[model samples]
Target: MFPIRDHNPSERTPYVTIGLIFANLVMFLLTMPWGLNAEGLWVYGALYAGAVTQGDMMWGLLTHMFLHAGLMHFAGNMLFLWIFGDNLEDQLGHLPFLGFYLICGLAAAAGQISAEPGSTIPMVGASGAIAGVMGGYLLLFPRARVDVLAIIVIIVKVFTLPAWVMLGVWFALQLMGGYTTPGDSGGVAYWAHSGGFVAGALLTLPVLLRKGGSRFWSRTDGHPPHDPIDYGHRSRVPQIPRR
Candidate 1:
């Protein structure tokens, strides 16, 4: 299942979310035409991970977060970012929000690298960062409604669900996936997922603390200060018709 969007639109536009989606796309296109093969991807990964290259590319650890493996990888990351990032940016404002995202992503990589420091596999995708965004969303607005698209065979259904339930389930799956997997650096980076979430929650704690978090909850009543907007028309995930 994929989330098309949320039923509750933020009172403000999500500039960071849109920018992140475009940035990932542009980076992917830069690497895609080179075939993104083992050698190519490895090179990109090394450069992105800030490995000990002949020259300085130490910043790749941050840059690599924006690179993706393929269309689906990019799409999935973008979907979550789109669903969850805007509200975060809305709440945290621009620079701090960006900082939180990068910090969470780096923390995620730190966890993955700790698990596989010597492995020569290249990590790509904004999932770690996006997972962080999901993390923050769960904490800030647990009860907000998101539109989910569920598909089974030819049957398709769309519905609005509380953010806590959807994000909570996804977070649990990541934890489970992290435990069940073989800590395979070559496959899904479940550690990144597990780590990113922990980072996001921890990172957001400061803000919650400053705002008298429990008091903030009491003040805002666990939702945003603004009224929940209404959606006159339901949105469906735009299916890609196969050729």
Candidate 2:
């Protein structure tokens, strides 16, 4: 299952979010195999736990967030950013939101470095940072409705779920993956994802408190402050029947 959209809408344009997406896309294209000196760029941009722990190539902590291993990785991270970023950007404002994003990303890098300080494999992608955005979105709008597309064999279905359920499940999976898989095996940076998520939520607590905390939840009913967008359709999807 993957989240496709949300009912929550931002009251203003999410300029920072759009800019982030565009920047990531440009970076991806620049780092593509056929692009200019892709190998050299990856060497300079990708994060390596060993390099960081040894006080070398420390810049990867920030640069790695803009790098992706492949097309699918870039697409997935961008999609998540697009879906949940606007709401947080709306709440935090553009410059602050941008700072929050980078801070969360740094925290994610720290998490990964802590997990495998001696590993030499390079870590790439915006997932750890986008995971932070999801974290903030969950804290701010736990009850907001999100549209998820679930595929089962030949059956395709779209369903609406509360933000907590969707994000909660995603977080749980990350924790599970973190524990089950070895950190230096060079796969998903589960620790970074979980760490960034937790950091994002904790970071967003101040904003939540300033908004009247529980009173704010009561006023907005755990949703966005503005009116929700109605897609004017049900969650059912056209599916082919089995023989």
Candidate 3:
């Protein structure tokens, strides 16, 4: 299941979110040629991306967040950023949100590296940063309803679930995967995802407290400041004539 949207509304335009999406897309296109050649992939990934064993390029911590392994990887990370980053940017303001993103991403890299410091495989993607946004969203809008598309075999359904349930499941999966999968494995950076999320949630705590914390929760009822939107639908099936 993947989130389609959320009922929460932001007070202002999320310039940072849009800018991040644009940057990620541009980087993805620019890096597409690297995927076609094995040597190119290694050369690019090492020079720009972060690896547990590579300590020469200190900038890799930040650059790696912009690099992606493939098209689907780019799309998935950007989609999460689009869905959750806006509200966070609204809450933290443009500059603060940018700082928060980079910090979480840096933390994510550290987390992954800590999991296997001797591994040489390069880790790339914005998922760790995006996971931070999800963590913040959960803290700010636990009760907010998120529209999700669920597919089971041949059946397709849309369900509106509370943000806590949706994000909790995602976080849980990351934790489970982080523990079960060896960090030396060259694949998903589960530890980064889990670590970034925790950092995001905790980092936003002070902001939430200043907003009144429990009182804020009471006022918004753990949702957005506005009334929830109606996502109901009328059946599309043609009606049969009644006897």
Best by lDDT: 2
Per-residue accuracy of model 1 over 144-190 as CA lDDT, tens digit each: 87888999999999888888888888888887877787754377788
Off by over 4 Å in 3: 34-54, 233-243
Model 2, runs deviating above 4 Å: 233-243
Model 2 agreement with the true structure over 112-197: per-residue lDDT tens digits: 88988898999988888888999999999999999999999999999999999999999999999999997689889999999899
| Predicted structure with the largest TM-score when compared to the true one | 2
Order by TM-score, highest first: 2, 3, 1
lDDT agreement with native, every candidate: 0.77, 0.92, 0.84
For residue 235, give model 3's deviation from the true position in Å: 11
Candidate 2 global TM-score? 0.94
Cα distance off (Å), candidate 2, residue 37: 5.3
lDDT of 3 by residue, 176-204 (tens): 99999965777888988998999999999
Weakest lDDT window of 10 consecutive positions for candidate 1 = 46-55
Angstrom error of the Cα, residue 118, model 1: value is 2.2
